[model samples]
Target: MRSVVGGVLSVVVVVAVVACSSPREPLPGLTASATVTTAQTPTPSPTIDYSDAELGIVFEDDQSLTGDEAEVYHWVATLETEYWRTLTTNTVSPKLSSIASPEIHVRMQQMADKNASIEGGHIGGVFRVQVRDVVVEGESARAVACLDYAGATFSDPNGSYTPEEAGFGGISRQELTLARVADKTWIVLTRTAAGEC
Candidate 1:
């Protein structure tokens, strides 16, 4: 009788194990399903469009500007703004390189390096930038601007004057040659002091 009971128990255990391991099928009128979802990438925001009037820039025919001409104008304005901001803050902003061409970027980097060397720190005064003219031809263009250095100063950390303070002079004219790269972005190819400031 004990052997018979053991055999019955073994049979019950085998049946339970088989049922648990077997694949399940949905009953009629019932269904099993799984859902998969994918994430979408967000689109970048458009760049802000700035006008000559907004930037305090004066030009001969500011009223009428072709699309390309306007783009070049904005590029130059943005570049100058970033340059002065860097000077005043005494910090190199990545935004400067974005608007500058390869050569201009290198020059700006050098300036930033120099600014980093000020032992006691310095204060940069505000200056005015007047856009004289901008001429665009295809992917290349030239922009002339007058940078007024009046009231600008770089004093030493000890509140004493330094020779570098004399470096800031009067208004100077700057000429910039720009090229529209393959990415359709304008970059300053070269920058030079055209005349006295």
Candidate 2:
């Protein structure tokens, strides 16, 4: 009987000690440490401006025109009207007009016509260019552009298709040399098609 009482008392004491030693639960707002959860808002995307003269050509968004239809037209127009016009008016040599045994006006018109069929429609792709090298001499500067052309469609709306029809379609990798005509104004004097430069 004494042994049983001692055993019972020992078990009671052990249970009390353990219960007292256990860590107490934290009060409502009081905690040992804090886990601060942060709520982050995304930053808005920037709007690209292509009309800045200082950012001309170089400021073009090379990726936006890919999936957007209207953007593609605007992109092509910027290249043909803004960039190509500068080249034809300021840097194109008279010799190039004779290279095809044709007048420069005729060749340019032909090019414009071919470009017309590709732009402003869903049958083509857009491209972006990066200026890789530039050599400035006197009033002229030769600049090279590394182009990335994609989503190009070579077929005409009239059911005619020609990938070889002089800038018709397909991503043709080449280097174009442009010269500076006026202060901060440059133009492409020569362009070698399919010539990787």
Candidate 3:
């Protein structure tokens, strides 16, 4: 009797193994050798090109700017964009030479170094400047602008920080002093924060 039970159990185990290992028939109208494909990634859009005249450097009462004053305004307005690009590319831009003085360039380089040392890594952010007023006196020029930090964002490995959280946000008025260089270009000599706009 014990041998007979053992023989039955062996047959049951063999049947279960065969059932699990067997292949199933394909569905009607479907082939077993059909290929599968994955979705492709979408391409990124090209960056928009903004002309120098449309950099949002507004003057009071639509006042017409002189040739030198206009040049200074355009250069100062574009500095914010250049600074942002530097942060993303992790390389100092030669364009800075035309916009900033030697002392100001040194300060910008220091800031870039600090950005590189940020915990985790640094991501790009938006920086916009509006020229409220530009005063050109002989070879010297002074500009008052409002720097908007609302759209600025910084990210780390752990998380992200906004300009406000980083204590560098809101609308603050800045005064920039520029001097006409020998190349018939204006360079920012000093940039200081004035009171709120």
- Deviation of model 2 at 50, angstroms: 4.9
Better candidate number, 1 or 2, judged by lDDT: 1
Q: Tell me the TM-score of each prediction against the true structure.
A: 0.60, 0.37, 0.62
Compared with the true structure, the alpha-carbon lDDT of candidate 2 equals 0.44
lDDT of 2 by residue, 43-95 (tens): 65554544333322333334332223223223333333343442323333343
TM-score for candidate 2, residues paired by index:
0.37
User: Model 1, range 1-197, lDDT digits (tens) per residue?
Assistant: 99999999999999999989968787897767766798889865554443244323322223244467667777776787777766756676688777776677777777877877877666555556766467988889998867766645566666744334556566678898889985457887777887764
Winner on lDDT between 2 and 3 is: 3
Winner by TM-score: 3
lDDT (C-alpha) at residue 92 in model 1: 63
lDDT of 2 at 197: 29
lDDT digits (tens) for residues 1-197 of candidate 3: 99999999999999999989968786898886869898899865542232223323222223245577777776666565565566655656778877887876777788778877776766545555667588888899888877666766677788888877776767888888988886457778888888777
lDDT for residue 137 in candidate 1, whole number 0-100: 86
Order candidates by TM-score, high to low. 3, 1, 2
How displaced is residue 167 in candidate 1, in Å?
Answer: 1.1
What order do candidates take by lDDT, descending? 3, 1, 2
- Candidate 1 residue runs with Cα over 4 Å from true position: 1-66, 160-164, 182-184
